[model samples]
Target: MKTDDPTMLAAHDWDFPVPIAYGPGRLAEMGRRCIELGIRNPLIVTDRGSRDLPFIGQLQSLLENEGLSATIFSDISPNPVDSEIGLGRKAFRAGGHDAVIAIGGGSAMDGGKAICLTANNDHDLWAFEFEQPVPVIGQGENFPALITIPTTAGTGAETESTAMVTHADKGMKFCVWHPDLKPALALLDPELTVGLPRTLTAWTGADALVHAIEAYLVPGFNPLCDGLALEGLALIAKWLPVAVDEPQNLTARGGMLVGSSLAGIAFLKGLGMVHAISHMVGAEFNTQHGLTNAILLPVVLRFNLPGQEEKVRRMAQAMDLSDTSVEGFIAAVETMLDQTEIPKSLGEIGVPADCAARIADKALKDSAARTNPRVATQAEVQAMIEKAIAHAR
Candidate 1:
């Protein structure tokens, strides 16, 4: 976000983890890309809110003009469930869709991936879950492709190869992973995000920040992911406030958009307690993912990142902190929390105080906790949740 050049951000294509077409107004080229994927008919998977956006209609026209038919499947929820994916699979089959174009936030994208993975197979969805002892035998690789166009700058679902959906019966959010689930292309258009509510802009930006922070601290030897996380943390720290305040600033929007995707890419190295706890909290409270993350991050940082002096120093530098210590980075998070108007406590946002044990039990079961630098016991996690619930930050 700081540069001596003082130049405009330009549109460009990148192929780090996938084919990414990033810029403002790149939605105009969606039709050409569909053709290249041999998609004569595509299913547009999005949430009800995004389905009502004007660009949805324009996107249909864009595809239609290119000799491709696009159908809408917008029966998605904020946190996708197995039933929603079932409906999407049915819609995909009924429409005779050749590929999928998921264009919205994380839920829509995850739903799209689940639909794509199960459209041609009758395998039980849970059988393919990453945590299953035995993997499901079948998949739908024969499908043409999946293209993700994110309207929000969080979750990085565009770059993820897993779909996190709630189990209706279990009442918990769980993820399914398969290499085939990764999107063939991700289109990032800052213009599409300009209309996002200011609060959502702030929350989602904080979500990206948490992603980079957690991934950076995940005990790992992947220097590639480490570098990406550090750089992404820097970008989000520099640009999130601008995006939140000046919703129309294309440069700030672009910065958060790319920073979010980079964080998403980095988290492929794996997340930590932040996601582990957030996934469960979201299932129980139906809270926004980013809001929960933003509220929980300050607390989680103290619990997870205290003694890693070297990593802490590097993170401080990445965030441009003058003090270059853990507390300095935390003060920065607290400042952003105020700027974003995030609640001081999870209880303020409606997470009940009495449910810490249940939430912590489930959070421990979540795969994300496996990579947290400081391993947590159930009591430790519950205590952390209690403090979070009580406005400990």
Candidate 2:
């Protein structure tokens, strides 16, 4: 029995930064995964609009079928605010939830992540906004196990450890981060994303595009993120318009989902001005984050990519554009905007052009702004915002 065999190979395990169970019907595996995570009592956090959706009930029944308890906390709104997550933390604690099963777009996913962050921590939520020396996040049950099922491809909140929640007192969206907030698993079931409203499809796709572009352009030395961003850009470029026109095209949906996730991972290298500008605007206007990004993308790109012709050429190649110049890449972006019917100006989306100064001040303070290739001033940010307001008007 002790014979030494030279060819013996032991079984091994493989995992990514966040393990993803991806496909059309991966939602079916949720129950077993919950068990594996020791999540018998889970709180399902979602946005207000997603509460009545069929998948909510489907997931509930699926969990119940496994003898697990599923309670929904859909009090969150778009651009989720502090009060909502405060209430969610209360619900999670009161319900004795062992985990959070967050399902929906960015707001819900981000809210769930925030809830997980504040659920057991004694410090006030705002006190934890990412700082020089990160707070010691207690492990084990102090942080609830999280499983994210993203219904939208934008934000990539599922894969990231950061969540942007509005601080009601300041009326600002703060990026609060902790590594433990990333989900134990991300279920990317394209079937869930299919049939998304037309506007959302376009807007969220643009959000992914911005993530890829900004991640690539940010002053960075990470070749890994650069490669992922290019691939993500290619996928988004190819599939976004098709998804918009076709709606139920599984292939397009799957491509967007994968591309969006890649952008999510890529931006760990950090994002740039488009996100810096959009974050402040989204908080102030209560606008869709993706829509705001989509409108502001071209204007920000015109500013960031002008002197960088070599970078623009690579971006052009990734998008399969023939011209391979900064001008040509922008033309392609404009054409995409037109094809998807994205509003050309932030003004068209009810964002008042008058608040440029206020938005600029807040945007300059945003962490993303620091990573932008250009050292933009308050005046510069305001000018950019104003130009984006009148971009097509």
Best by TM-score: 1
Clashing residue pairs in all predictions, respectively, total 0, 0
Q: What lDDT tens digits, residue by residue, belong to model 2 across residues 250-310? A: 7788888888988888998888888888999999889999999999988888888978898
- Ten-residue region with minimum lDDT total, candidate 1: 1-10
> Can you write out model 1's per-residue Cα lDDT over 219-331, one digit (the tens) per residue?
96999999999999888888889888888888888888988999999988889998999999998888999999999988899998778878988988998888777788788
Q: Please list the Cα RMSD from the true structure of every candidate, rounded to 1 decimal place.
A: 1.8, 7.1
lDDT of 1 at 219: 91
Candidates in order, TM-scores: namely 0.96, 0.94
**Regions of candidate 2 where Cα sits further than 4 Å from its true position:** 1-14, 139-141
Give model 1's clash tally.
0
Overall lDDT per candidate, in order of appearance:
0.86, 0.86
lDDT of 1 at 95: 91
